[model samples]
Target: MSDFLVVGGGVIGMMTTLQLADAGHSVTLLERGRCGREASWAGGGIVSPLYPWRHSAPVSRLATWSEGFYPELALRLFEETGVDPEYRQKGLLYLRVDDEAQAERWAREVGKPLERVSADFLYAKEPQAAPGFDDALWMPTLGSIRNPRLGQALRCRLEAMPRVTLREGSEVTGFRQSAARVTGVETADGIVEGDHTIVCGGAWAAELLERVWMALPVRPVKGQMILFEAPPGLVNRVVLMDGRYVIPRADGRVLAGSTLEETGFDKTTDAEAKASLRASAIGIVPALAECEVEHHWAGLRPGSPDGVPFIGAVPGLEGLHVNAGHYRNGLVLAPASTHLLVDALLGREPILDPVPYRLEGRVTSRR
Candidate 1:
């Protein structure tokens, strides 16, 4: 039996398997589709949450850890795989705040220093933006990464490690367990037995565990994104105007998103979502008005009710652990979440507080 049977192949699952393999553990990763083609692929690749001060302390802690970890991790991955993930820190601009008092309060809550810029400074920094707000807050530490390349880097690096086995096109249908211990995973091909199993399937986590009578409260939140092909440096940095955001990639692609819906697993992009995202992009950067949209797509974020991911061993179940339900901040929290879960699995002290991430009577396997 392998040391771990990880279900799902998004950033969370990929990270879990990657880290475990790094620690000299035998891991087999099972995926329903091509690895990283789900939410991780469609995301805007913003390294920080939008107004992180609004999230809970638990969420913020994981985001903080990942923010510090990604730059170093990306560099190492690029060196190993020869694929540059393009980790860039051009900063994030928050435009049109209601008042300075609110912005300052949020900055204090998040424990991040913000530079307030007046109209002249803002116009000089972002010449493409429409003139409206007199002042805005600039988050210098905020950054972005090319998530598709990041996923590719992870897959390439992991595949080179002999201890790791990656199985794409393998959908997990159920589980093989004894009275209290999970023994294997039931897949489309056959039963793959393992000593332990972890479900990191994002939105599909709940559905996969439900076949085994586990009640994880994870739901799908659909977000649509619009991509624009702009000249290099058309937008200097990531811009947040009103309640929406526009992210400029290093390869001359600007991403504007997204609409949140409770649609169950449906990834269809409608005209209304496309138009709404286009309006948001043009409203902030008037220069984008001349830019044509290159593509439009949707992704499903695994959302929990309180937004804190469920990252602990399932109650009343042995050899079964889970790390899913990260909502919109999945990409930012992937590194820390995977580390914490792996530490817990090995019976070692976790770096982050595990109390807020524990699943109990509400979402136990016995339920």
Candidate 2:
């Protein structure tokens, strides 16, 4: 089996390395900081797209496939690592769905279970919700994961694998090329060589690949979030309105976020954003207004045009590949994205068509 070097220890990279190692290939995963402490750790793990109908076909395909695969993956991770990701299908309620017609059409086309529910039903289901809307769009099958716990489970599982080498704090500065193929990567400590190199360095993917003269169009879109440590039943389900959401955890914590600021890797949490998110959270669930804001943080999502991730071999470069640019849906899309990449790498029949994700002339401009 080919020895592989997987860069970026976020969800995508770790999952890729896990799959490769499970297939009997030796794999080394390198992370600049602690694994999963970046975007992967800081995401609201909605198992579906924020607005599924708003995305393109490629995003839909990956998300759909991943939605089916996540339950098993979460279960397996918890069983192996004893860390429950808290995967729960608490359903998602859209308080203000403007284009219900288009949403219904998309749901019908995609076979996703969606319902146009009445205000009475919505209130009865979630009495804490702020009232006034006549009706709402309900996605009953939608779910979420506690992303930080998921990362912990992945880290634990990876450490237990003999074929996997988990290297934290190893930043890859550049790639060592032999003719047209990438032989290895140049890290902070020393050169780490491998037969093939896969760059999964989330927001840093573009810069890392640029070292090898590969211009990948991946940028960091900063998203800020605020957590409210409220009573357990204050907010029951994931409530979304005006592009922001309030997600209730099994414990008492509720998460409200996020602003899509194209601020170029700045993760500093601002007071304005915190106020806006707090208001939004209170607007969705009135009881949260009194809850203490326990934590506020930001994450840099690997943004791409149309939120479609690149997941294939780099053009004009052999033995070098990327599976980055997942934007806001990294947690939701991780299972299928990694599976597709691994299938292509191992020369097996892919789970889906790999053409849309291929990196050729796909990225016309930086996102």
Q: How many residue pairs clash in all the candidates, one count each?
A: 0, 0
Candidate 1 per-residue lDDT over residues 62-115, each given as its tens digit: 998999888998999999999998898888888976665766786787688787
Please give the CA lDDT of all the candidate structures.
Answer: 0.89, 0.91
The TM-score, computed over Cα atoms with residue i paired to residue i, of candidate 2 is 0.98
Question: In model 2, where is the ten-residue run with the lowest total lDDT?
Answer: 358-367
Tell me which residue pairs clash in candidate 2. Answer: none
Cα deviation at 325, candidate 2, in Å, is: 0.8
Which segments of model 1 are wrong by more than 4 Å? Answer: 99-103, 364-367
Tens-place lDDT per residue, model 2, 304-339, is 876889999987778999999999999989999999
lDDT of 2 at 258: 90
